[model samples]
Target: MTRIDLHAHAFSAHTAPKVIATLLTLAHRACPGFAPHGDGTLPDLLRAEAAAGFDRVAVCNIATRPEHHAYMARFLTALRSGAMGEEAARRVIPCVSLHPHDPDAAAHLKTLVALGARMVKLHPYSQNIPLDDPATIRLLALIRDAGLPVLCHTGHDVTAGEDDFAGPRRVVNVLDRVPGLRLICAHCAAWRHPETLDLLLGRPVGVDLAFQPATGVEPIIQRFALEHPLEHLYFGSDWPWASPAEHAARIASWGLPQDRQDALFGANAARLLALP
Candidate 1:
């Protein structure tokens, strides 16, 4: 069977290495207990993807600083154009972003897309912006006009302080304003699991099983696949946060009936994205 790891992340070494290294150092200094894992480098992620038999992995890089936009844009252009080191680049599809609340947010998004951003990554928690903030409405309009999907970070981000709600319910407010925009709720919509399922049962939005119980939630994910239109659901590992091997194993051990497993693992994403 064809394998498509729809949600995994890897950074281009050519961009932001020094900044990322500095951040890693600062993280250790600020939180002595925080031991970072191997940086999700291109080579490491590609190896993991290959081992998991993933033919394509969509990498969504969210912005953390103003300067990051251009660097990330360039990196994404390389991925979309198949310019990121031949072998590693082939499996990665790059998602783009601008701080949704940025002052020139709309223009930035347009520039990113023109530079080759296939989708946008929005993080309410880390970005410190309410999902329904007026700026997001404009941002959503820009996305809709561009005909790109928005992969929203709709859950607790372990590193960012828990001041915001990453719940799917909050996103409904934003969705209400831009009903036609394509949205992919990352991490199974976090604490809003069934509500997330409910949202998708009636409407088409993408939900990724990035951190769901490697064991417990398998049945729920499978149930959703069997009960809902297959195109509305997608499987993503949130790699670097979760391993490809672990994600593959989790789906395998779920022991779902063959068709359901096929949908969750690959078919659904291919159909949703209109991939081959």
Candidate 2:
């Protein structure tokens, strides 16, 4: 298996502005003794990936505001094209994002494809767009046509737990409406939600293993990671909010069969990314 981490994030000084700082603060408040394992930088992410024993890591970044898209797209292009640096070129798989409400959404998608982007990320919580909104459906269809897998932020988030805008109910609705989408719902398809676990088990969408231990979701993570079919699961550290090494260690201790472990660690994601 390729040992690829399907979800993680890195940011340059230019990208870690006020919005990024606010998110970090909220994560700390949500998880006790919380502090990032890696600094918010590409080099730090590479170091973390190495520590986690990941052979390759997909670097996903977001731009909630349209004004930031140009800057973010330039950064993503550098990463996907392997222009960031030698280390990143060796191990990083770049993914891009587009705010669903961006008036120029089509143009942004075209730009990402032309830039050789391998995947996409969307956060309905931070981006304030409902999963079933007309705009989001249209964009998701375009991404499916482009053959880009999407990592969508789903379930209750620390920043706005009360906001059910990205809840699993809505996610499943979108899944039903937008057939054939290579969509990976983030945060273990949100086990905290009542219908989420059952819905996730029934749905065809991919689920990323991004369980946060500090949030008292360890048992839930154990159940989901162990029970979910190999082909439907992918490893996601949700790094910066959690540690990649800790999450990887937790799964390793499960004593799963080699092939199952391999599938959870990377094979499924490699197939989704179409890596040879």
The numbered model that scores best in lDDT is 2
Q: Per-model C-alpha lDDT, please? A: 0.67, 0.78
Residue-level lDDT of model 2, residues 1-276, one tens digit each, is 578888888877576555457776886665555556666777877888898789899887876876656866787667656688878877888688887777887787888778778899988877777877888898898889888999988877777656677777888888887899999988865635756767776457778878666666666566667777778788899776667888888888987778778887988988888876
lDDT of 1 by residue, 1-276 (tens): 567777766665665465456545654542444332336777877888888788877877777554567766677667666676788566666676677656776677778777756677777765677667787677777788888888787755544554555666677876788888888777766542456665644456667666645224455555554565556667788776567877778766756577767887788766655565
Model 1 pairs whose backbones collide = none
Q: Residue 204 of model 2: what lDDT?
A: 70
Candidate 2 — worst ten consecutive residues by lDDT sum? 27-36
Tell me which residue pairs clash in candidate 2: none
